[model samples]
Target: MSEKDTETVVHRLSTIRERLDAGMDRREFVRTLASAGYAVGMAQLLGVDDFLETDDGDVPVVTALARDRTDDPFSLEKRTRTVPAEWYAAVEKAFEVNEILASSRVMGYLGSAVVPGDYRSGTASVTIGVTGDSGFIGDLIGTVSDSLGLEIERFEDEEFETFEEFRDGADRSIRQPRLARDAANGTAPGGVTCETDSTMATLGPAMYDPESGSSFFVTAEHAFDDEATVVGEALTLPTETEESFDLGTVRFDHPIADIVAVEPSGRLDPINRIDTSPPSTITGQYTRWGLADLLARGEPLEKVGAMTGHTTGEIQGIDAVTCFTDNFCRHGQIRWGSEMDLIDGDSGSVSYHPDPEDPEESVLVAGFNNARTWWPGQSYVWGVSAYRVNESLGYHF
Candidate 1:
């Protein structure tokens, strides 16, 4: 169907749902309609007769990412990964379950993500995070889980700890990205050297602010030792022989996203690749589908932190809402790598997966590598997914 036709179908269904919601709970109303076999009938009405003939259990794996137009600075090289239509359809349903749980925000809910099963299984599960009482939340989630054919694994009292202890836990031990670099390695693009106290963190890909329609550099916001003291401070890139060049000035800093946006200081323009041998070009951030596909494939992500240099590791969890770090919670977090894989200076680096089709120097950003789950029984890194940054701040990379 054309986009216009799809829009019309959506509008009609939405209007019907709005009317149905008058007598029933919004959630219940939709659940009832779906269970009453409206999905197939709705598809027929919308000229999607082909959908009715497909397996009821099937899900479509589709990515929200696309090639860049002139206004989209985050666009990079184009690529695609093929998956079985059945598997894709399964994943699509799992994402729906995840969204419902996320929207409910039931008491003590931490966060949730869609995890795909083995290739042949063609199945996917919704990983739900709940703290305190599992009995209550589980019962509530069980109804939806059963209705949707989703599996729920409860993470008991899973509290996410921010890097507060990691920072306040020790004294400032500054280390530059160049220290890990070879003589042949040129200035890293994503790696930034801040003037605040010569602090270091990995530079993420260049991003565009929709409001301003201008470009800027990005990095982990937690890199600033003291935000109040260092706001608007200049950040630069170190050179081998000549003096370091002015890179940009800090423009914005926020904790939820844990990213810092910088205004270029006129010395150089922002580039999308990292600073490693055969430099990896950051084409774009992964879509929700892409991350789920990686999780299902048991893939490993790599990053080039100013301190840690380059390292690879697997994803442990995704869509987690961490609470131990602050009074509130952080949602849509990706947990991967290990404590040993991340440290103080690696905060701003990105956890990325190499493009299978173009493994030479191209990749998609998995998320930001900001902190480690540094406690017992948990031994992986955690950071805001790249898409979450765009979701929260509307800055797309």
Candidate 2:
């Protein structure tokens, strides 16, 4: 390109950057780039590579989608925060590298996750789980690490139970009801028992579908044997008073993510709260970068499962892709807590943290607790992240 054309491109990018700095969202920025005839490698053109060396300033990043009105489920507002430019850049690069590794689908690759270092380090790494050490895998990792100046950690893959095996051994018997009803809200909060045709799982927090303007009661999709059979099946919520009532019918079933959204069918509605000793209201969900920030700070995540009640543990990995427990890979997962934190009946429970903005009354959802590692070498609960669920299915807590 000529100097004049290069100047024109730079000028356009400057204007776009100004808009972004003024609070333009990611989707809008992408649309703007598309309209400007920018190709797939737009990041290069935008000078994102310079972020590594340019370390003086901070960059604005959207962290969460929070409720503007506590009572209104649809009043979602984007939450943004400014972070050290170097840390942001490193995390972005790590995410890109992680995607590359996942897409490669190298031999014996079981799963991988991106782990961002602290602000002081200004670095990130990808931790990979493989069947065993191989020359090809080592060479690929070395090549990528050398090229990008990124770290790659490898571990031997341990035996993990498939969904079928896990579900088969799970205790299907309904436990004594301990539902904590919020009489004022007239809603059923999560962290309580919900029944499917063959098994029972903990209900997830209330989720909002923006397109349909509807709220749903969510749980593990794998709670039922087949999606076809779940169509007309009713999801029943059992209360502490030994009363069982129909909550709704399955509105959406996503097998890959192992989540299901149930449309309400009765007077009681699903609320954005967990039925714990002191209930935690769902305020919003963290972004992928937000989760990385938590990891850098050594913050831990908490969950209230039907079987195990409440438990807490450290954040292990983010933006993970696991191909171990299923035939197809599950992408965009958050592995946190511990194997003991999650059990059979905890399949549909959610893992969350106290909302940074309002720690007392509200909490931010990290993801769903769908499965746990039962192997001897490793131990941690893994599940589909809330950000992934929103990105894939357009649902938010």
Candidate 3:
């Protein structure tokens, strides 16, 4: 080879090496390799496909709104308000704490929720529900404070007796649980009462499973079983005509989250709109940060029950873990204050806050209003928070 030819070849190779070192044309090079049937191996090398081989247990995601962020399940970018970055980070930590405490099954632990203080305070704390004594509260706070390197002040809401934390509460006039034979199914969206072959409960908003992409009728898991769940029990909706339509069968019974997923069997489809005079569409769900913002602002939550129609109440607590009826503790529960009427037939109704961006038209689900809790002086409603439902079960509104 001639010296001039060798010099030209060496210079060209050096330029190519520099370009690769600078990550120039990286994507194009990978795509070229992918087209040659080495996509899987190349993807692994790029660390883009490692999740496929990782054996991590079930991971739940907060689903994005259907309007624009359809591809983003986490919806990290779709936040409507400008929350301070520090506050968001702290609230997320609170959520982690709530999850840990619930999963740990600490002694005297009833439930807990992440409670965010004023943004100006730049702080957040978890409010825990303990049944027997106040001794556990100090130990929990001190342990967390020691690890976090900050003074985490904790308070106790001590009540002597145990009250069943029903998310939805209605008129107490009717004591005995009777089946409402009103129009069932083929009529409205969610928020109406649904009759399982035997008992009655409200139907929740439309939710789709990320695994199958199939829509299903949703409700509280306890709604189906008067004693225990049937093999193929289904729920029915009431119409104004007093007739009914079969929506579907109870496909999934999430005992931990206390949620039930029903596969639609009849012609009626589950709609995103809440059942009202003029229906209300569920645009999105409140993120962990979003819930904290509401708690900070002392915003009110609203819901429509078959018995109560529509009612509004303030957020008393968030990130609550409740051990009311279930053998296992229910984590990430929301507690609403004030007189929010929820009742027997309202077990599956959803509690929501109006979208501050669009109050008159759309709203975001706060949680499933399952039951109201009261013991003499203390009266507030508790239910599985919407964020918990998504984070734990991966079913988002």
Candidate 4:
């Protein structure tokens, strides 16, 4: 049938249904339509002879089926190993990173749990979209494990269109790419060194705000020593604090992202602009990077953590879940590429993407550096997404 004829047929059927609903008698419906000559017109339009066929063989095959099941002759149940809290944290981190990286691949695209695998024997497996390099993936796995004090036993890598793609078998071959080192490594630029002293021996990285006149760093609940004096020597100290850690306003500590904020005593000039911006476009109108902004794969970014100094690298691949070791799983929130290696002390640092036109706006934080690549000669960075970070802490970017 022609397109126009098909439209007419659908429209006529719809009109008939309406008329019947309005109380048109079944016997009189076709008769009344014939009196109006609508039926003849429809028949002509549809090629009248096409409706005269009486071949049962042309009928579609519709079959009745029944559910089939069998009772188990012997009792049997599936078993799974319980992962520790730290291992679970790693798995979650792996999941988050893969999701975000995949989301960044497409415009206005947000990635969800792509590959969520079950825990077996001693490991959890996860897969994310393919970025530029695969070595970075290894780096992320190692980094997550070290942060949680766990190890990743087996690492399974896969490229997926969606989470279900990973679940289903596809005929595509997976490849591992080598990553390059960042341009900025082991070189310290001459700049103002801002520091804060804490009475606690184990203070995590502190965040600073030059614009809002606020500077804050987080430390563990037990960072405070007995005397409540800055545990380490003061360097560019903010000021004197009678207490070791801030207790009244806000305190955050956990196996993940562990640390409490130490409010700055004096006014702090928000340090704006990191030399990471690309040179183009208008200024001021540039967008800012925060926990809320989306991160792209293969994009080179920098991190200034408490442990690792100014380092840079490209973002690798991201996936929903990654096994730290056989027993430990780390979920990825945000995964990026980098060769500017990280260590244990680099927990809290700001990761900023360099945009030439939007230096101030580009200076955003990657919450804190969680882990590094497991094997040597490889480097990667993993952290909490800006969205998740803000949601949990109720902090504005």
Query: RMSD of each candidate?
Result: 8.2, 7.9, 15.0, 24.5
Q: What is the lDDT of residue 317 in candidate 1?
A: 65
User: What Cα-based lDDT does every candidate model obtain?
Assistant: 0.63, 0.78, 0.64, 0.34
Clashing pairs in 1: 58-89, 59-88, 59-89, 59-90, 60-88, 60-89, 61-88, 162-325, 190-203, 221-258
Descending-lDDT candidate ranking: 2, 3, 1, 4
Give the count of colliding residue pairs in each prediction.
Answer: 10, 0, 28, 58
Question: Please, what is the TM-score per model?
Answer: 0.73, 0.82, 0.70, 0.37
Put down candidate 3 lDDT per residue, 1-397, tens digits, no spaces: 2345434433443444354456656566455445533433333222223223423332232322334453433332355556554454455556655655566554566666667776666566776655444364454444333322222223244543434333233355654332233434443477877887657788887886676777778887777664465436778876655667787888877766767888888577777778776678777788655677787777888888777778887786777777756577776778885444776777788888876667798788888877776544446777887777777777777
Of candidates 4 and 1, the better by TM-score = 1
Model 3: CA > 4 A from native? 1-66, 69-77, 89-93, 132-136, 146-187, 226-228
Q: Pick the candidate with the highest lDDT.
A: 2
Ten-residue region with minimum lDDT total, candidate 3: 146-155
Please give, for residues 312-379, the per-residue lDDT of candidate 1 as tens digits. 88877666566546556677788787877887677777888876556687777888887876544567
CA shift of 275, model 3, Å: 1.8
Candidate 2 lDDT, 1-397, residue by residue in tens = 2345434544665776577668866668678768966543344334444422354688788888888998887888988888887777667766765675676656677778888788788777777776665345445444334434443445554355556776568555655544645334468899988888788899998999989989999999888876454665678887766677788898777889998889999667988999887789999899887888889888999998888888999998999998877678999999997777877778899999899889997999999999987555668999999999999999999
Off by over 4 Å in 1: 1-60, 64-82, 104-107, 147-163, 170-176, 179-188, 192-198, 225-231
